[model samples]
Target: MASGLLIEEGEKMRTEEEMFQMILEIAKQDERIRAVYLNGSRTNPNVKKDEYQDFDIVYVVNDVIPFLNNPEWLKKFGEIAVMQEPNSKAFGWGGDHNEQESYTWLMLFSDGNRIDLHLDIKKVALDRYLEDTLTIKLLDKDDFLPDLAKANDQFHWIQKPSQIEFHGVCNEFWWCLNNVAKGLNRHQIPYVLKMYYEIVHPQLFQLVDWSVAQKNNFQITTGLFGKYYEMLLTKERYEAYLKTYPNPNPEAIWQAIFNACYLFRELGIEIAESLGFSYNLVEDQNMQRYLTQMYKKENDK
Candidate 1:
């Protein structure tokens, strides 16, 4: 089992209170930086503290031109072990959404803290502010920011899916499960699990989360491996989900593969029913059973 080293290290890296103080001290003298706000795990109380926790910060700046031109100004925060400017042509994973005018900097530090700094000339703050749910006003020099309520996880909440969307996820999950079966038959354990994890499992878990989120008002993250799922999920159901990953033997692996098919079929049906979609569990179940039988016959031969 791969231990969660990234999350554990992030908790040990820095104190939130100290980081807040440092940001405030810097903002006091820097006239260009008019306001400071935080986002991501720092604001999320439910998230466990770790060194990998990013400081999702935004600095509402004055001109935003001179600083954007020279990225060195950011080094004042700390000796940057390494960094990324998402908007830069050299590294444009997230391209400039606005014409050449609007600029945002997405940075990851060596200490494992990340900051997504958005630069605006103060004129566009109001319009941009209303559009995003996670925007929190920390310090506003001109008192332009409204008296906002405490931050909530509403932005990250699982939205209720449409019938079409629910069915689409189900279709994708079952389709990918066949790939896992094929990989396992070919003695490719990595290929089998990769498909199982990335495609099939995510769909199953997403629906489960969506169902729970609907019940609880969408306020939690289940973590990557359903790490926090036990809080919301029954122990029996959670254990059942775990059964989908059996020991990696050709004979024993089929039982696990079948369990995945069963679990996904059940969950997908529930999700589809909730959204008023036609559940196709019969079709998926038959397909999964056929795949399992074929793999078993081939192994025997």
Candidate 2:
């Protein structure tokens, strides 16, 4: 539709069905394309669709060499605005052996639709994708693709936490407060930011993730790094969580570090109580006081 994808039969805009028909039509023309499938968010039943969601397609073929070398085949799908072929020499691919059997084409169409298409050698490696719960088979001529046990969101569900694991996070959260103070005192942004993210924030997110897991009886996901916190968290708790983010200035960063400590202490207590573990109030109080003292001294200097 952009320029050369051939909006065939006098169609102006290429719709979803039309795109699928175009993909399948190309596969039908070639004997090598033995199977067709879809993966990623497009196959996830829970995910909401928008114009930006990519059409993740996989073509299981007898061979991948022709598709690898030929650039003409790509234009058939649509006028490609931009294309990334990862395993190609032109794209900094190592050599022939690295990707001899499989290849990838991340195509962006002119009409704002994108498709991440992969061409793989049939039978040997294609079965690996069939097992993933977030996949749907579009076509299989010779019954090559296997039957999955069941396709569901079980792959991302939250797992139960052990006491040792739980304690480790609480200890890690309180201990790392010193590092952030040290970074702030030294006027080093990297150290402060790193300690906050790699040490402090993981625990913050983990506590929230644990809270969600507890509320849901460890039966659901918290998304990738508590992205679904708003959905699962109470409005009051969520509003408090929002106050923890601070601007990059020294004073703001100082306030943010304390905010994080308070939030973590609150969430950690709830989670520890729920899990029947002891929450270290002594460590929390000691760390909070130490952080305040360090911040005050740094400002006085």
Candidate 3:
């Protein structure tokens, strides 16, 4: 049982230091928890640190059921903005039903801080947990945990697309754009947005990502949704990329689809040339022509 030096409620928002102390205190009080560790962005030196980054914590306990049963125990951390027990069978998680292997409680506090906590059962073995390069041991009472390797971004580093991956992404992007145009004509706003954002945009983004990676020798990252893309992108290409997200109006949506098509075409070609992978230019041309004709037909109506 960990000593939750319970931070009293009804006060100013708790700081990061207070949060870590409270977490360590909880581990200290509970003899059942033999060790603790941190993971995710917190341990990655490559990433610029931020307040919103999750405190990816792991509590190595001999048994998991007691903590699983007692959900209220988490209230000690702070005024919880929100919390989720994602791995529980009660939550309908499919695999191992969050078995003794490990379970999780992802939490956000009112103070604008979040702690993504995992309770890894001791019986699962230390070697399994150490596999993630983004891991750091916080506390080990019984010396149950071992000296893990230092954290690295190896797991997340951008990888050069294989010929199959490059070809597939190009095929999917060009193929899905027609769905957006058709949805627009049918006044299926949601459907069009879904096709563009969910289906086509990912591939477009990936193509642009490949362009970035091609320049950097496929080593650095652009982060989620190209948060770091601007720093890496040529000014002209980045501006064109920004315009791809248009207003929900049908005309704007149509234009944005064309914008994305042009960007993807050039980027895909560049990536293909650099990587020596084949590009589906004919499919790209056919889709562009189809979109142009569709736009004219819809306007004429």
Best by lDDT: 3
Query: Could you tell me every candidate's TM-score relative to the true structure?
Result: 0.77, 0.82, 0.89
Per-residue alpha-carbon lDDT of candidate 3 for residues 150-235, written as tens digits (9 for 90 to 100): 78767666898899999899899888888888888889999899888999999989988778877887777777778877888889
Considering every candidate listed, which one attains the maximal TM-score? 3
Q: Could you tell me the lDDT of residue 270 within candidate 2? A: 87
Q: How accurate is candidate 1 locally (lDDT)?
A: 0.69
lDDT value, candidate 2, whole model: 0.79
lDDT of 1 by residue, 1-301 (tens): 1123333444544466766677777887888888877766667666767755666767777776778667777775654554566666666565545423447766554545555666766667666665546557789998887766666666676677777787788788877777777787788887877787777778878777876776675665665556677777888878887787667676677777677777777777666666667887766977877786878666787
Quickly count the clashes in candidate 2: 0
Q: All models: lDDT?
A: 0.69, 0.79, 0.82
Tens digit per residue, CA lDDT, model 2, 1-301: 2354433455355678888899998888888899888877667666666666788888888888777677688888887767787777775664674455778888887666788988888754565675567777888877878766545656777887899998898899889888889889999987788788787888888887888889888877766667667878999888778767767788888887877888888888888888898888999999988998998899899
**Sort by lDDT, top down from the best:** 3, 2, 1
Evaluation by lDDT, superior candidate among 1 and 3: 3
Q: Give me the runs in candidate 2 sitting further than 4 Å from their true place.
A: 1-14, 82-97, 123-127
